[model samples]
Target: MSNKTFFSLHGGVNVIGGTKLHLTSGTDELIFDFGATYEPGKGRFDQVLTVRPGRETEDSRAAGVIPNLSYLYSPTPSKHVAVFVSHFHLDHVGMLSYLDPSVPVYLSQPSFNLLRQLEVVGEGIGTHRDLRVFPYGEWIDFGRLKVLPLPVEHDIPGATGFYVKTPEGTLAYTGDFRGHGLHPEVTTAFFARLGELGTNILVSEGTRACEAPRPDAYSESEIGTVIESAVRPGKSAFFMIYNRNIDRIATFARAARSLGRELVLTPATHHLFRTLSPEEYRLARPAVFVTQEFRVKGLPPWIAGLDVPRLTVPDIAREPARFLTELPYANLNELVDLRPDGGSCFIHSDGPPLGEFDPAFRNLKQWLRDFDLALVFARSSGHASPEYLKECVNLANPDILYPVHTANMAAMPTPAHGILAVSQLYQKYYIPGRRG
Candidate 1:
């Protein structure tokens, strides 16, 4: 048997999200980030037409929703195989349920907490018995291959990058990150550590590479400022944000406080906040939005036991100006009861129905029109800007570059003194040993 290490791209390539990278050294194999893609309305399955029960893995594979690697999804256990998850984003951890539970799946502590919280809300990726938590900067060894989970700053908490040490050389994988988030120092330190380690190969995410400039790309602080400015006195303001973006949630909380309006969150968002950041939850003291559905079906034990104030549709409709609430697109029907005032507005803060491409975006627009709510955007991307990406590449100073999680591979920055090699899906590229 040869001692050469090999690498292959099984999922995220020429696309944004659904990153799966396979690395092998002899009999030991490592799979990083088993996730699904973010292309809405392009695939065979949709909201109405769902995957067949008991055949999810098979159906998804046949429809090209997931990689066609049977070994990873095999029912039988393989001791030599181990999986590493970078964060809890659905695009990065969506397919873990299909993976064999016997395989040891490793993640950060915050990622684990968030995943369990999501499970409580019926949005989890199924259960796995062998979930393990990896501490930041600690090395986990598997034969000749060792991986170090380095914390990074992304929109979601517990986002991480991996530094893999193979017999051949060292490779750095940036799962997903940004410099304009709440913590830029974390991102800076990550690249600084990569440089100190003298990494040989860089596998980076290029979500914004070659994409046209977004006018709404504000920094986290800037987003808060925009939110504050958008919410006028004597008018209700609804913010639609991704539940996992705790930083944005804090921003909304602060903005509401500054505007002297009560902050109201959906039950799911409230649960996530209390579970993930208890200290912040206590400080914010936000109210929970109690929908008619929750009243009819009875609140979950978590919501029922909460001591925080609750806001009903009638409560908000009576005094719209006193509250700044979360309005998820799924709960758009609640607008019929709330009957927002004349000057009220809806603030889209990096939530679902994200863009014109998604089918639900049309529905969101229709709802806003029907409710006569002014739509405004106050959002920031979770990924780094193109310039920041180039800066990251320069800082890492890798000998070779492999760009993933992007639609345009050609747009990725090449190392000043190294090779820019794009790995084809399922095609293995051997990593030469140091002595070879």
Candidate 2:
């Protein structure tokens, strides 16, 4: 067998999310992340035009939702293949169910636990397979390649970066990390360790590379402060947040408690909190929102089993000053029943329909406008700032830099002494060995 190691980009090049990176040493193959892109209306399929039920894989491939890698999904596959997930984001793990069950999939213990909970709640895609969970800093051998999973700080818990030692060289893949989130120290330590290991190649994410710095960009702590200040003293407040963003949830919970108001959560968020962190759920003491749908169709078994305080729209509407509730975009119709006061605050905290690009975002704005509610943005991004991204790249100081998961590769900073290779989709590049 040839001693050469090859690298290829199957997805997540020039786009913000759908990242699928493939590396190979002879017959041994490793796929870092097998997720789809997050662009809402740009894709071939939408909410109304859905993919076929049984032909999900086939439909996705035809629609360019996923890469056409037969070896990874076909029945009679070739080569030795394995998948290592960096986090539980849909853009990173959306296509995992489509992969052949014979291949082994690895994830961090926390990610595995959270994924199982998501599956149980019917929010997860694909069926369970050969999922192997590993602790932080443990090395897993894959014949000619060995991988070390390192913890990093992203918006969601259990986020990780990978340090792979291939036959040709060593490379570090930074999987969607930020230095301003709840755990900046973890990100700092991750880069410090990469510098110590002396990587030959660095595959980094530059999600914010092209965007100019904004004055509204606040740290996670700052977001909490902003939330506290934005809500009025004698008015009910509704905030939208990503369900998986436990830190943000904690921030809201803290803010609510400080104001002597009860933090109310959607049933889905309550399920996630109770399942993932029971202690947190207890400390937060949040009340679950009993939606109209839940009342009409009845609560599911998972929700019925939860022993927590519940609140209805009537309860919130009666004493608006006493509660702060979570409002998902899908539950916008509830606003009609709510009939919130004219000056009520609606804080958007990094939830779905994130930007104007998404159709749902416009709909969210329309709903708030119809209710005459004040829309306040209290969001901190999950990706690192451009300056921080450059600092991270310089710290690692790899021999070669491959910038991925960004809209503009030109905007990303290159290592002072390294070559910046603009990678193309499906293009193969030979990996070089470390210098003596």
Candidate 3:
């Protein structure tokens, strides 16, 4: 009888029979991702609507981030359990600001650091949420709730899937993940371990399930060959990509070296490199530091003494005349587009554009055309690809598959079996309390 699985508060799950479990037991209730929904019909991030009283409710109605509660309107402390943040993306962590401060929230360390940086860039305010930042192997105890962070790769840093050990059983919540080869093999190895972890009720992210298979991603070396073959000495390659993907940076740097150009690191990009490990920061050694130092809170963490090539923004040229003459030897393309000037080439390291619609193609072409530059896109995504996404579902073999964080939110269909589509309205769900 204790093995019964009921459909309680199933925001994004499928339940057999009609068993509804209230979201509370003892002093804990497991609140999964409370994502923030942006206002509908708006182009980009217009502004953040505060989650107060009538204003937030009104804003949610107007913006279309429906199913949002007024606040932590729960009447009792023992009724609500701790919140588990799947990943660091704003949508997944959106409602972080509005939750009851007494409720414990958990996130990865890197994600927490990135969140802090983002929050500083955002509303310019600190938080009062009782967040406990844990590493991949550590666990947190919230009375009866036992939680652990399992590492995963995404476009964001410190991305993780969670495993919760409750009195009822062990449930794993995959905030967001992909089975793509884009991530190192270690990523898959981690998931394989999760499979052995005996995930009882799996809640996975099926965001790309319905999307068609993307092209085979190129390795950093193969991409370097493309860059070397494409660019001539007189071209500068410019890149645009997500800041969280540190792997792409290493790829570009190594590729630049193979092409005979000293790896050029932008100031903003340099800080990220400096913060990573030596191997992780392996950017074409005999490597050149285009920027001197990365500053955080007015102090650099630690400056490496490794001898590498380097240049500053002001030193792109000598007397503003022979910018080409000072350009590093080898990989420097004599002819190409995306220039700091006539003899410069660029690589748009920044990743693809996100949100409702991507402007990457349009904006990229426009930027190149605006300066009469030529370019090629060498970018890859952090999400899992189709085949891998399929594999994760197959490996986990859950009863239902749910997807989020994309325009085709509901498009990610379940491969396991039948589907019970949660209505787009009210979206109420119930789950039984875990027997202690």
Candidate 4:
């Protein structure tokens, strides 16, 4: 009972997204990042072949998606169990709604706030009523153990890593993070803290851990410059990007302001901006609102009620250079309305599709071709490359490293520490120097 143990419920040897891990000290337990994995194309279930709401637990078990954790969701959990969400990425927090309200789920303050905003914008899947705020950079006592939440930088806000101090030793869990986003120092500071704590076991994301080290990865600042360079004097600039990426939005806003153009946003995106950083909304050039006629169907009263000035397709078509608007893959139909000038530019800020075989990319390409809009890739990956991953492993200098969040662990370059441990699902591994 004195020993500290870890169980890799998911994301141990596989690249699947539902990263569920259980840590235990005596009778107390904590589940980290209970989310769903990504299924390429359509596997057991998809948007069309949906899981019934009332039977998600049974259906998920049958489909081999989430593991059986009925104990955590029981009317009274036998152990003091709490679930912590790392971030708001769909692959990371998609399954949260299925968790029973009896089990307390925790997330960063900003993430909780953003989740509320997303709910208002109709992006949330189900109700998460038992959710609690997990404060960052502070240690919270859980029985005999103490867990410290450390803020980390990612494409999305409220990303975090955790350090759990048990009687045996400390376990460092690096939630999805990258050093090239808006603030690289956050990661740098996290590495320094890990070194000081002498983290015994490190669970790190190896998203790009298989790729070769290259200097071509652009920092967030570099992305802004690339966007600025592509905006010709009289050509409209429309960017297709991940709407949740706040740093990218800032980059686009900065570039558009420099060009003396106002940034245009869809209702959903504007809601997200206002919820996350109202100050940025004020500092940035006043944005022009546009209704999403097709994607969101109709503009809800919440959107129509806003006092911001509205811009119609006719206004944008008349002076294409006066605005920079976002166009996602789902909303490509807007191209028909804007009828951009021949020289107008379309920046594909979102990287290539998950695989070349994806049909969505093909559709996007055909649309761009038909519209005569040149596609320019002005984007950087949100994950660190393999070489930098090795550097991070060495910097932490943990006693053992378990790499997750990668498709090809076999192709991963070995870290300098030479302590990569191949963890398996459901196997309890006790850290070295266990307490008697």
Q: Which pairs clash (backbone N, Cα, C closer than 3 Å) in model 4?
A: none
Clashing pairs in 1: none
- By lDDT, the candidates rank as 1, 2, 4, 3
Question: In model 2, what lDDT does residue 410 have?
Answer: 88
Residue-level lDDT of model 4, residues 1-436, one tens digit each, is 6545544555434674667777887778888887777655746897788789778788886676765767754566676788888888777877776666777778899788778888888878466567889777888888867889998888788888898898777788888877777788887688778878888888887787767655656777788788887888888778877767776777777788888888887777777776676777776744544645623565666676777767767777788988988777766788898888776788878643533556678888888889988777787877776666666777778887777777776655454654777656676776542322
lDDT (10s digit) by residue, model 3, range 323-378 = 21112112133222113554334454434443324443565455555555555555
lDDT of each: 0.86, 0.86, 0.50, 0.74
Tell me the spans in candidate 2 whose CA falls farther than 4 Å from its real position.
1-3, 433-436
The worst-scoring run of ten residues by lDDT in candidate 3 lies at 13-22
Local accuracy of candidate 2 as per-residue lDDT tens digits, 313-405: 888889999999998988889988888989999999999989997888888999999998999999999999988988888888888888888
Model 4 off-target regions past 4 Å? 1-4, 213-216, 285-298, 351-357, 411-415, 433-436
TM-score of every candidate: 0.95, 0.96, 0.68, 0.90
- State which candidate, 1 or 4, has the greater TM-score: 1
lDDT of 2: 0.86
C-alpha RMSD of each candidate structure in angstroms: 2.1, 2.2, 7.8, 2.9
What is candidate 1's lDDT per residue for 158-207, written digit by digit as tens?
Answer: 99999999988888889999999888889989988988898887889998
Model 3 misplacement above 4 A? 1-27, 34-81, 94-103, 113-125, 135-139, 165-170, 181-200, 216-230, 278-314, 317-346, 350-356, 359-361, 409-413, 417-426, 432-436
